[model samples]
Target: MVKIYGHPFAAFYWKVLIALHERNVPFEFLMLDADHPQHGEAVARLSPTGQFPVLIDADHVVIESAAIIEYLDLHHGHAPPMVPADPRAAIEARQMDGIFDDYVMAPLSRMVFNALRDTDKQDPHTITVAQGTLDKSYA
Candidate 1:
């Protein structure tokens, strides 16, 4: 059985869940939160960065949201692959994924992280830069 270690609120983790559901795959969810210290510790061992959304299939351990999604599609998907089989199409798909991750998600994540920091510890410069990136990406 496949086991996924992640939190529901995390976008990267959520992406993997959506992919699994879309492929009609059955798996176990190991949430990483205060109540699940063991799950977090397991992730700390499985992932280099101790990040969530790590997929454990048999003896294989996969980390990174994009990589995990591709792994699921290649190993478990039935018909059409999540990423196109065609070289050109695949490149385009990956390109867009990168754009979203870099321009949209990264900035949004930075803003959110900053928001979580204490007011005195928060970096206005970082928030401003992230906001600029978001604005440019949206434009």
Candidate 2:
């Protein structure tokens, strides 16, 4: 059985979930939390960076949402392809994916992280820059 280690609220987890749902893949969702017994250790074993949304299929382990999606599309024959078969089209798709991740999600993530920091530790200038980047990306 395929197992995914991640939190439900994380956007990257949602990205993996969307692909799994689209592929109609049956997977066991392991919600990772420091409070949960052994969950943190297990997640660490799967990911060196301790990042969420690690996919485990038997002895194979895959991390990173984009890589997970590509792995699914490649190995799971039943699923619709997430990436194009043609080299040129695939390159374009990956480029666009990076743009969205970097321009859109990156700034939003920075803002969220900033909000989570202690008030005194928070950087108003960083928040302002992130907001401006988000606005520009939207425009």
Model 1, 1-139: lDDT tens per residue? 7999987778788878888988888999998889988888898888999877899999999998899989988999575777788999999989988888899988998899899999999999998999999999999
The TM-score of candidate 1 is 0.94
Report lDDT per candidate: 0.87, 0.85
Candidate 2: which pairs clash?
none
Q: Which ten residues in a row have the lowest lDDT in candidate 1?
A: 76-85
- Residue ranges of candidate 1 with Cα displaced over 4 Å: none
**Which of the numbered candidates is closest to the native, going by highest TM-score?**
1
TM-score of each candidate structure, all chains considered together: 0.94, 0.90
lDDT for residue 117 in candidate 2, whole number 0-100: 96
Residue pairs with backbone atoms closer than 3 Å in model 1 (clashes): none
Overall local distance difference test of candidate 1: 0.87
